[model samples]
Target: MKTYYDVQKFFRRFGIITYIGNREAEIELSLIELQSLKQEGVISDEDYYQCLGVLSYEKEMAIEKRSGKQ
Candidate 1:
């Protein structure tokens, strides 16, 4: 999970697809799904952390981008 595309592919493996036009919202939903999978023991710690880091980075970038427009 190095990029946002990787994150989407990760979730797709679990039959999960997320996208609602907003980058921040998409990341937030992905985080929620990731947490649920973690709690259910559906994913390993390594994958979870890797995806989490990517999502966090993407979220931060989205935030910065949105703020820059204001």
Candidate 2:
């Protein structure tokens, strides 16, 4: 996968959907799925780390956004 969206799509192929409204929850679920895929050898370490980085950035941005809104 080239991006987080691509990684999410890859998971979707296996009926794995990590999106459930909350940004933090979604990111957590996505991370779990990414780890599972990595352990299963379905995705390379590079791809897994890349996707994790993206998700982590997104999570940080989300937290910042929410804190700013408060």
Best by lDDT: 1
lDDT of 1 by residue, 5-59 (tens): 9989989999999989988999999999999999999999999999999999999
Candidate that would win on TM-score: 1
CA lDDT of every candidate? 0.93, 0.81
Q: Across residues 11-38, which tens digit of lDDT does each residue of candidate 2 receive?
A: 7877898879887888888988888888
Clashes of each: 0, 0
TM-score of 2: 0.77
Q: Candidate 1 has which clashing residue pairs, if any?
A: none
Clashes of 2: 0
lDDT of 1 at 51: 96
Which residue pairs collide, candidate 2?
none
Q: Which TM-score value belongs to model 1?
A: 0.95
